[model samples]
Target: MKTEFTDIAVIGGGPAGLAAALEAKRAGVKRVVVLERDVELGGILRQCIHDGFGIHRFKKRMSGNEYAQAFIDETEKSDIKAYADTTALELTADRKIYACNSRDGMLEIRAGAVIMTTGCRERTASQALIYGERPAGALTAGAVQRYINIDGYLPGKRAVVLGSGDIGLIMARRMTLEGIEVEGVYEVMSSPGGLTRNIVQCLDDYGIPLHLSATVTKIEGRDRVRAVTVAKTDGSRRPIAGTERVVECDLLVLAVGLIPENELLIKAGAEIDPRTKGAVLNDRFETSLSGIFAAGNAAAVFDLVDYVSVSGEIAARGAVEFLRENTSDKNTENASGGADGYVPVIAGENINFVIPQRVRKGAARDLAFFMRVKTSAPRAELRCLCDGAVAEKKVCRYIAPPEMLSMTPCCAAEREIKIDAVNE
Candidate 1:
């Protein structure tokens, strides 16, 4: 086994990993390294050829590949070492990584700090619980995307998208452009899962119908998908009786949802939050296991790629600070009278979950809090309470479960914090 060392070791060279590596270098962290499972740096973005990305980050509309390339170019020009086609098989809570590549057989990398940007994986057909024999035509929206965009092969002539996620909406448009008939998009929830822009450009402009509160209950055909039975869902999201309709199509694309790929972190004895399905993090993106950080989709699924990059930068900054401090003391008390120099954050009212579930006491820098609401509201107020006193508040014209909310209120010293989204 080969042994190596780095100041920071970033796992998964996707958008988050690349951005983290670059920011670590910018933060004066020497010997930053990135390990990528794919042969190239770009992750899923490589296959996403559609535009509408980078509108916030670069101030211009760009394709997924173009957005990834901007950071890849910067990474290539720097001294940061990136190992492509390398997979991190094991990660320890103490910042040790066991990885393997074609050139480096069975290697061990000891890093001062570790950043996990492993990204998220799509929910498969079996997980969606559609009663049917496994058919060849049944695949995830990502598979359909790779088949058409990367391999230049249309998977089917007629398709039924089972979810209204951003990927499903985009694929609906892509399949239609490629001469494939997209029958319709069915979402189980009352509201669309994707952004409003996607609903307009992908479905509205393309004349594709979006069936809300509907879901595919069954799949038919042994060899290939011949049709599917879609039914209206009630308030509980269960298929309603007497509302089943058969839609004939060769393909069934499942865009149900995504789960963070944090198996490595979980196995390494890190505390996980059931709400986000990620790690319990602080304002600096530092996990409960000190020196280990998680960002981007691995932390929680953000609505935009710009947010993913920003998360990576935040984790990188946290990693750099950890290295400078040379200690794993998250409990170091500040001069302010705080409980162990940390403030526990709570999600109240309409809020579903909030990142940075805790705040380090007396940190001078402002911290951005990202959260999602449990329900939709026309007029709402995002309220922040410190020890039951109103610390900050912001108003919103509209808020929904699908849209994530971000706030960078004035930083506060350690006090029990609670976030609430109240309907006006």
Candidate 2:
């Protein structure tokens, strides 16, 4: 066993972890380290060769690998230390981390603060409940992506995608580019789950059909996927009895959903949010556990990678503030406690959920709230209420679940804040 100490220890080396580690180091943290389970610093980005990333942050379209490379380059130039091929096995509420790798058999790290950016995992065939045989060709869109993009091998010739998520849409186009026939994309919801831009570029431009309010109820084949039975669904998303159709294909690619990787956070005694399936966090991105913060997909799945990076930076700033306050005996104001006051931020009407479910008053001059809508709205009014009074209001031309809404409002001296969205 090896013992180490640092000001901050970040788990996971994906975009969120990379960005958080870099930001923490830049924020004057004496010692910062990032632990990545993968062999390389870049996580899933290495497999995402398609362009469309960095549109918000870099102001130019770049490939996922290129976007991750930019951050990797910055991290390498900074004072931050990153350990690749290291898996974080345990995290404690007191900012202790247990991790291991082949090179470092076991590591026990004690840090002033800890940041979790473990990212997310895609929903698989069994999880999605696609009743069928466990065939070799049945794989998630992300798996197929890794197979084709990273490993440079085609998984199948003909495929039937069971979800209309961004990854699925992108893979639909990717498979098409590779001369693989994408029979069609089916979504249980009436509306597409991905961004409109992806629907246009990946499906519309490629002449691929998108079946809405439909799903793959069953898969067939013993050795390899031979076909899938897709059916139209009712309002409850249950497949209708007489609307079943068989689509013959070698591969069944599932793009159903993503689940945040928060086992370590849970082990660390952090409160989990039921809606987001992440962590219940304060305005400073600090989790329920003291000195532990979560960001990016580990906090909640963001529609854009740019937003993921933003969350990481926020968590980094929070960690820096925490370390600065605790390191000095003179700074006795415990920001994690109720000395500054905390206001619960409730999600109301048309909003699925909001990050930073609670806000610590005086933590920041301006607090940013990120949320996703439950349904599409052509015109809507967003309101941030403090103590039943409208603190901020904004009118939007359109809002959808696929695009996360970010609003930064000046902090008010109120103890309660509620964010609401309604069709106008």
Candidate 3:
């Protein structure tokens, strides 16, 4: 067993971890270490060859690999140390990281602060309740992507995508480009689950039909996926009795949903938000456990990678602040105020949920509140209330559950903030 110490330890060397490690180093942290399970620094981004990333951060459209490479280059130039092929087995609430790698063997890292950026995983066939025989052709969109793009093997010649998520939509286009036929994209919701731009660029541009309010209820085949029964779903998202149709395809690619990868965070005693399935955080991205922070998809499933990197920076800043404060005064108490001074952020009508569920009055700097809507609205009004008084109000031309909305409102001291969205 090897023991190491650092000012900050970042778990997962994807975009979030890379960004956080770099930010911590830039913040004058004496030692910053990033642990990655993969052999390389880039995570899933390495396999994503499609363009449309870096629009918000770089102000230019780039491929996923390109976006990740840019960050990798920056990290290589920085003082932060990266441990590739290292998997974190456990995380303690007190900032101890137990990790293992072929080269390092079992290792224990003690850090002043820790940041979790484990990202997210796709919902599989079983999780989606798609009654099916365990067949080789049934796979998630992400898995197919890795198989096709990374491994250079086509999963199937013909495919039926079960969800209209961004990954499913992109794979529909990717498979078509790779000379595979994409039958159609079936979505359970009336509205598409992906961004409007993806719906246009990936599906509409590729001439692939999107079956809204529809889902695949059953799969048929023993060796491989021979066919699937897709049915129209009613308001309850239940398959209608008489609206079943069979789609014959070799592949059943599921793009159901994404769940944040937070097993280690949960095991470490961090409270999770039921809505986001991520850690409950404050304005600074600090989790329920002091000195522990979460960012990127590990915090919430962000729509854009730009925001993912931003979240890492936020968590790094919080960790740096925590380390500095604790080192300055060993007996200093947690600056986060009491329950009364912590303002609860409520999700009002039509709002799915908001990040940073609570705000410590007068303890936070200018912060952006990220949230998603419950439904689609052509025109909507977003209101931020502080103690029943309107703190900020903005009119948005369009809002949807797929696209995350971010707003930075001036928060008043010692007041509860409520966020709500409604059709205008």
Q: Could you tally the backbone clashes for each prediction?
A: 0, 0, 0
- Each model's TM-score? 0.94, 0.96, 0.96
For model 1, how does the per-residue alpha-carbon lDDT over 109-199 read when each residue is reduced to its tens digit? 9999999999998999878888777788998999999999988999999999989989899999999999999999999989899888899
lDDT of 2 at 146: 92
Scored by lDDT, the top model is 3
Runs in model 3 lying further than 4 Å from the true structure = 330-334, 337-341
Error of model 1, residue 93, in angstroms: 1.4
The per-model lDDT (C-alpha) reads 0.89, 0.89, 0.90
Q: Roughly what TM-score does model 1 have, to 2 decimal places?
A: 0.94
- Put the candidates in lDDT order, highest first: 3, 1, 2
Residue pairs with colliding backbones in model 1 are none
TM-score of 2: 0.96
* lDDT minimum window of 10 residues, candidate 1: 330-339
TM-score of 3: 0.96
